[model samples]
Target: MKKIFVYGSLMSGLDTDGNMNGAKLVHADCRTLHKYAMYIYEDYPFIFEGRSNYQIKGELYEVPADVLKHLDAYEGDFYFRKLAEIECGEETVSAFVYFGRGHFFGMKEVKGGDYRAFRGKDGN
Candidate 1:
């Protein structure tokens, strides 16, 4: 199993029936990774290229290898998942990050907040 950091709709009980709705949460006290900007495109969430000192809130989940395939499919061509060092609790853990292919470049930055928190599912 591999640990994944989720900061958007994949969070527990918010959408897709919470973390266990599609994936399993392995750590309870996971640390949030900061210094990055989150953006929303259509209904999907993506991180933008930027610099920040604040941490974005999220959780660490243990995903089965098979489940990763499904997640990859859901992300589609708009995003490419890359291995990244994310803060989990007190230690740093390697997790998959979804990189957007410059789809939302025209939109303004969300400042110091989660992108999903601002935009709706329709990307409005």
Candidate 2:
């Protein structure tokens, strides 16, 4: 299994039937990192972009490689999977971070709204 960090739809039960699908929820934590901004791309949930001081709240999940591949596909064109360090409880761990692409070129600020407080089956 591979360890990964999820901040957007994946963490909010928007995808994967609200059970984290098949991924194992290791834990949740507040993580801040350099050079990253969050945005709701095309209004289809939020995705990270650019490099900034923005700290995104997220959950750490231990998932199979296959499942990770599925997530990569789900993130689609505007994201590239990159390894990142996230604070998990008393320790900091390395996980995957999705960086925005193409259409998201030149974005530098965090957008309005957030997925961390989102609810409902529709992921809105």
Candidate 3:
């Protein structure tokens, strides 16, 4: 099993969660160890490496090799996966996070770095 951080669709209760059908949820209250830029495009969200005001909120999951392989292809070339530090409870661990490549011109910035809240989920 490998650790992965999912902030957008792949997170539970989201549209793309189906892609991670075989993954196990590890932590739900996970946050990026550092601040990063987050944006949304047609309801899809992507995170990018950069300094930002808020740490990206996400979830941690443990997935098998086959699931990881499927996620790589599901993310496509527009997004690249990289190891990033994540805060899970009082512990900090490295997990694979999908980041956007190149310019995301028209994408709207996600304030508070939460895709779920931004989309009006959870009554936020």
RMSD of each: 4.5, 4.0, 1.7
> Which digits, one per residue and each the tens of the lDDT, describe model 1 over residues 16-78?
423245577766445445466666655566664455634565667888887777777766887
How would the candidate models be sorted by TM-score, starting from the highest?
3, 2, 1
The full ranking of all candidates by lDDT, starting with the best, is 3, 2, 1
Name every residue pair that clashes in candidate 1: 13-18, 31-89, 34-55
Ranking 1 against 2 by lDDT, winner: 2
Give me the runs in candidate 2 sitting further than 4 Å from their true place.
Answer: 15-19, 45-50, 103-114, 118-124
Best by TM-score: 3
lDDT of each: 0.62, 0.65, 0.90
The residue-by-residue lDDT of candidate 2 on 1-124, one tens digit each, is 9888777667645554354578888886546454455665444444555546466767788989788878877778767888888886678888887666654544434442235654333344
Candidate achieving higher TM-score, 2 or 3:
3
lDDT measured at residue 83 in model 3 versus the true structure, 0 to 100: 96
lDDT of 1 at 38: 60
lDDT, candidate 3, 12-101, per-residue tens: 888778998999999999999999988888877888886576899989999999999999999999899999999999999999999998
User: Which 10-residue window in model 3 sums to the lowest lDDT?
Assistant: 115-124
The Cα error of candidate 1 at residue 65, in Å, is: 1.1
